[model samples]
Target: MERYVDGFVLPVPTEKIDAYREMAAEAGKLWIEHGALEYFEGVGDDMESDMDGMPVRTFPEIAESSDDESAVFAFIVFESREHRDEVNAKVMDDPAMDPERPSEEMPFESGRMAYGGFRSLVSYEK
Candidate 1:
């Protein structure tokens, strides 16, 4: 079956990686609880691509990260497009997921975050 994905890239301050990891773990739990098939968040460790004549920019370049910042790439998978919509609605309504709720300072700058919904064209699992 085809899948749907919501992807995000954030430029996070290097000093805040530990805080970011804690926040991501909590968010991942909420997403899974709300019916997301998978919730994955990764920090850039091998972002430096030295491939000669590469046609595209690397993750760090695309994220416009500075020396003090690291690229954070995250995605939540769903069974299908409709399922994604439903799950996201529920997740958004849950108060625990609200960013506005009184909490610790955000680990990353929200303005620089990039996000989009993608239709998975080719999915293979063995």
Candidate 2:
């Protein structure tokens, strides 16, 4: 079945990777509990690439991050756009989300995050 995905690209300070992981783990649980099919978060490992000498903007460059920050790519999967909306509504209402929390307290710069929801154009699984 075609699925929906909410993706994010952001910069996280390398020094707070562990903290970010912890926070992401908790958030993932909330998402799953609220009905997300899957939740995944990954920090940049081998992001720097020249693309065989072709000019390309790297992940860090896209996220506008400094050397001390790592590019983080994350996503949540859902049955459909409606399903995603339902799950997100519940998750947002959950106190764990801290809807009113200060951005400065977050592990990464919330303002710099690039987020979007996408309907799957093609999908395959083993």
Candidate 3:
């Protein structure tokens, strides 16, 4: 079945990776509770050497990350485009997810974060 995905890439200070992970964990839980199919967050491990001859840009390059920062890639999957919108609306309305509410400050810069929604063109599972 085709799926929808909301993806994001950002730079987080290297020293704040653990803190970022903790925050992401809570965000992931809220997303799941709101009906997100799956939520995944990954910190760049082998970003530098992996793109030896590739012409495409790497996560760090795209994020303009500094030496002291790590590139973070995250995604949340949904059953479809409409489902994604529905879940996101509910998630945003939840007080716990509100940006205006008092909460631990983000470990990364929000202005530099890249975000997008995509419709899966190909999907496979065993």
- By lDDT: ranked, best first: 2, 3, 1
The sequence of per-residue lDDT tens digits that candidate 2 reaches over residues 10-120 is 999999899899999999999999999999999998886858889988788889889899999999999999999999999989988876877777899888999999999
Query: How high is the CA lDDT of each candidate model?
Result: 0.91, 0.93, 0.92
Estimate the overall C-alpha local distance difference test score of candidate 2: 0.93
Better of 2 and 3 by TM-score: 2
Report the Cα lDDT for residue 105, model 2: 73
Cα RMSD of all models vs. native, in order, equals: 1.6, 1.2, 1.8
Q: For residues 19-108, could you state the per-residue lDDT of candidate 3 as single tens digits? A: 899999999999999999999999999886456676878899998999999999999999999999999999999988757744447788
- Model 2 worst lDDT window (10 residues): 96-105
- What's the true lDDT of residue 92 in model 3? 91
lDDT of 1 by residue, 32-99 (tens): 99999999999999986878877768788888999999999999999999999999999899989766
**For all candidates, what are the clash counts?**
0, 0, 0
Give the winner by lDDT: 2
Stretches of candidate 1 off by over 4 Å are 102-104
